[model samples]
Target: MTIGQWYNEAHRALRTASTAMGRSRALAAADINAAVIARSAIYTQLARATALLVGGSPAAEAPDRARATAILARHGQSLTQLYVGLQAAAVVERQFPASPATAVAGPARSLRRAVDAVGVIGDILASHVPPGQTPRTPEGLAVRAGGGVQSGLADIARLTSAAIMIDIALPGWLDQRRGHLTEIYRPAAEAARWTANSRLSAVARELIALGRGQPRLHGLDVARPPLNPAPPVSTADDAVAAVSAARTWMWQNPSELTSVHLQLGTQLGLAVHVLSSTGDPTMIGGWRQAAIAAADLRATSPVGPARDTAAELTEVLRWLRSIGKGNHGEPAGRHLQQVSRLNSELPIMAATLHKGLSAALQRRDLFVKDEGVLQRPAGSLVFRAAERWRPAMRDDDVVQDLVRALVQGQDADSRSEHRSPSSRAFPLPPRPRTPVSGAHWAGFDPPSGPAVRRSR
Candidate 1:
């Protein structure tokens, strides 16, 4: 049976035993049986948990087991509770003085307390089960305690011939949270870093440190090799969202351009493109929405910078969508050109962004001012954010290939439509509004580069 089914059945048995207090001998006997089922079922789960944590039989993967072991060895005191619970349960079975309905309530209560201890340990270990391995904790993950409601988790440490065994480990809520693997934590981390906002960066680091087994949310030391990638917990979509935010900021302050801002935008765009190509749902979900949001945020803003930024981002999003879907006809050629241009410039912008981030790390010039992390130089936050979006101009040949393939696919589709001939009756697509290119090395470039340090 599935582990869930097994767990449910066992839980029902415990509930039956716990509530059996009618003064009859029959009710007392039934309670004992129910308690036995509960104990056996839970002990089984505990065994499975130990196997998972210590890498015992059934799917002995080395790395995961080792990691689990280290976590347990370093901070696993929950086992003591498990042992105490088992001892309590053994006492319940060894003496049935309270087996009569008149005394059943007291016995049931003791049985429940022991069961609860084991259950909590189960949950604690569950929390640490690598998010990837939770699907396999049932099946042979079975065992039981005698009489009713519980068993000794001590079975894991057999005692015989004067030899005591305590090899396996199971983690409990030992120290503070050493690490975490969750859905939202990763994206939150990436967004924190790219903004360079002292607050966000600090939050991101805490999340990063959690993965490395430091749960206090403090140590996000970005190592100097290969660009400390957004923490592994981070999905590609988080990275996309980060870029989209950067792009929107640029749109709001087109007049302000800096190497960091420009390079960031370019790299963000490139990261999105590369990630989308992978088709992994986590990386691709909500991507188109992110593009649309960047445009909408700007479109609703004020007159000069707001509307202007809106217009620019809207055009970029439009191009991104059209290219992705392989939209055809006259616009296809221009879209191809835009894609080609962005591609060529991608590398130069990437190099610039890398250099900027590296320099920021070395110079210790990340965003933050007043003694409190919240305090910053007047207007620097927005000004800095705006500058981060306008990347230097360049081109890429890889995009040319992607665009060419798309154009070819569009061509094939056009032929398919023409051969059918019902296509002419359809309304023509609206002409695209010209993109309001950002002010950079391109046109209205502003004071940028190395000045963020002075802000610090």
Candidate 2:
């Protein structure tokens, strides 16, 4: 070939390679996105199925099963479409000489968008049923009328696995925002510590009682005047003595009444978390009453830190209630308002528990903003659960584990004490490459030449 012709051919080949690489990158991005979307659809279906099957099985059988099946069929169609799109993208990606460089940014964005969209869909599905029939109480009319319990749970397990897949990929996106969170958490933690300590102290003093049934003027040793002029007697000291007696009574007599302190503490803690996150203060009054009840238990006993703190906690809670009503300036900081409102809603049985927990979360929110080593180990547990569920496609044990992890993080002193999953066995059929679809569905794509595989 002539020199000029050879040079032209080289330039042509280079241009072709660049074009091919760009296409490869685009396809890879699409494949990642498609996989996420498919998984989301599957997760949604499985959740619906499980809810219907488990929650409704006892109430209604035939209609419920039929309804659950129908729902699954529609979801199956969406899954098929997602798989087809991903497979096509994957095939395209494999043909290019150099895989596209744009994949780094594109895949992350696609994955996030897909998962978020599924969340919206889940919300919509939830709405189609009724309110208050969430994971906590799934046996509502819709579930009972639509499917059997076994199938419902099976579906739930399926979708939960799918959602985890997306959530698993979220940490990288969150890492960029870690620095901005530090400034927000520090002040909050300081305020929480100050608040919890002050409350505990107040409780101790109120229950103190001293004078009741005292030995009548026991003969005093008159040998010498006490140095530093024995500290003046105070009502606070008297209150402490009285409360101590009450404490003695409870410890001595187990048969008289049930010791519900620990149980009450747990209830109070949950109430506080619910109230704080939801930003409502109406609940604190009940908690105030609970603190009083606790205080009342030791009304005739000597005062100690626990009693004093309990009293202090009540006073702090009262103050919080007042602030929630109008004591604070208009439009307090959002977090403060939330904390206040949560304090307001305290049930009568859980005041101390709520107070302690609210204080703890508040401290953590402010003091530990580094996305600490704790967060990683915790996240790793979640990731591992997700991984375990991927191939098995089982949702129940995985979802249970996820919830357990969340609870552990919130309640445990140290995240280092990781709890293993309660059940190691997953109950689900192996994943099928081509999910079955129904006639009414519109999104299914015929299988592509190359198969697409979802990442574990």
Give the candidate number with the greatest TM-score.
2
**Per-residue CA lDDT of candidate 2, range 310-374, in tens?**
34333333433443454446542343433522221122112122222222222221111111132
Reference-based TM-score of each model? 0.21, 0.23
Best-fitting candidate, scored by lDDT: 1
Which parts of model 1 have CA positions greater than 4 angstroms off? Answer: 1-27, 55-104, 130-388, 391-456
lDDT of each: 0.29, 0.28
TM-score of 2: 0.23
lDDT of 1 by residue, 1-456 (tens): 212233344344344433432222222433443333333334444444444334333323322222333323333344432332222222212222223434444324434544554454445334323324522111101111011011112222221000110001001101113343222123322221222221212222332333342111011011111112222212222222322333334422334433334323443344334423222232222222222212211111235433333344334444455555655554433444334323322222232222232223223333311222233468666422222221111121221222222222222222332211111111111111332232222221113321111211
